[model samples]
Target chain A: MDITNLESMPGKKIVKHLGLVQGSSVRAKHAGRDLLSSIKNLFGGELTSYTELLQESREEAMDRMLQQAKSVEANAILNVRFSTSSITQGAAEIYVYGTAVQLEATE
Target chain B: MSGGSFQLIYVIGLLIVAYLIGSYREKRHYQSIIKREHALNSLPAVNLKTAPKGHFQHELVMGNVTISVDYFKRFLALLHAFFGGPITSYETLLDRSRREALLRMKEMAKEKHAALVLNVKYETVSIFKGSGKSIGSVEVLAYGTALIPSSQAVASNVATTTQ
Candidate 1:
């Protein structure tokens, strides 16, 4: 399925508005990575492990969102947005939402 | 009394070292960020949801950065919390991470030969949330759709023909 954060596909026409679809995933940091991150904090720099962990979580959320779009028979998803919130000290939830729609070729 | 003095000295030593290293590292990062931003000035990323009128291909592009708060800044933040003032120490951290994320996104667009990026948005997350004891870090993610103008293809064609 085609996915974009824009309101509408640039070259395509939206034929059907399928409403809002969302996906979310929550993940907790591993103890080992936390230890490493603390050490990295002392010097100050990018937290590679946390970056990777969050990236993975985001991908999973996107995947679930795409699945929802597919189930609804939508050809594209638009106006996509992502939000992150910490549910607890170590766990974070990544939520992605977008409007699912069917698009017709304008060309 | 001597043991208490020893603890105080140790804390002071850590603060001094953290301050020196953190400032040096932040300076270097800002230098690199400014240089790369100058280099990538040609590509403009905007918040417009619709692309400019053109026959172009679109692709999703994103860049994310996670930066950890150094001990020195965290200490400053603790003081700021106590005094209830604007925590200026963390401002640079957020600014650097946001710029870095946007630059990375633009770099990806440049790779795709996209003339413009649209509907750019940012999401910031405090990955390790809660209190001061935890090592705090912020993650910034910048995302947009890249529009590769069809004119570039014709331009490339003309170049090949001229050769």
Candidate 2:
């Protein structure tokens, strides 16, 4: 599982040489926070609702990513990336992706 | 005597304006903090590094992040209206970006089957700058090495399953 081998497996179309593993989670409830935030705006105060939403979404995304790694029989995953997109007014999509590789023993 | 009273009144008005301006800046600072906290917490913990088992090989892992200044600026402005001072929006942005980059590096290592990442470094590049009232964007890059544990090299580390 050397990081260098992440993209360099021998005889391994990346599509075939590498396994396609994925994890995804949809999060809602940010809209409620956003609403509260607008109200707080008039009075000029802290927005606690958004704070909670962000925390919850982050955890859910991470959990999904881990499950993906386990499915690939990969003890380790490298070069992970995260992207966020709005699914709807109150919901968001979080995606985590990386290369999965098999480990070899050292001499 | 009336003129003297008028002058005093003018001075008091100027002081009030200054105080209001200062308070506005302070409010903006807190508002940015709240926004950044939201961004950071919204991001999930991701590890992509794959652990290498025996021999060590040098590897490269890269992570990139782009942040919108407009979103951040508005958050700060909101705070400024409530409080007053120069808001430190840039710092919060930097912190969140770094965290994201680091997490990416770790995920790369986990994917490669590396035990850990080493010799990590970071660089920041300005991708865009605000013109007038428009917002800007900043990019952050993180790179690191992924290594595997030596213990796995031994036969004992191999997993055997009964059929």
- How close is each model in CA RMSD to the real structure? 4.2, 11.8
Cα shift from native, residue A102, model 2 (Å): 2.0
For B37-94, candidate 1 gives per-residue lDDT tens digits of: 9999999999987678768877788888988777878888888888897899889999
- Residue lDDT tens for model 2, B1-163: 9999999898566546534543464457446545654644433232343433445544555555544333335445556646877556555545665765566556655555555565565666443334443224344556665554445423223542221
- For residues A28-67, write the lDDT of model 1, one tens digit per residue: 7889888888788876778888778788898999999999
Worst 10 residues of 1 chain A by lDDT: A36-45
How good is the docking of model 2, by CAPRI class?
A: incorrect
Model 1 regions more than 4 Å off: B133-135, B150-163
Cα miss at A15, model 1 (Å)? Answer: 1.1
Q: How good is chain A of candidate 2, measured by TM-score? A: 0.62
Q: Ignoring the other chain, what TM-score does chain B have in each prediction?
A: 0.87, 0.49
Docking class of 1: medium
Q: Pick the candidate with the highest DockQ.
A: 1
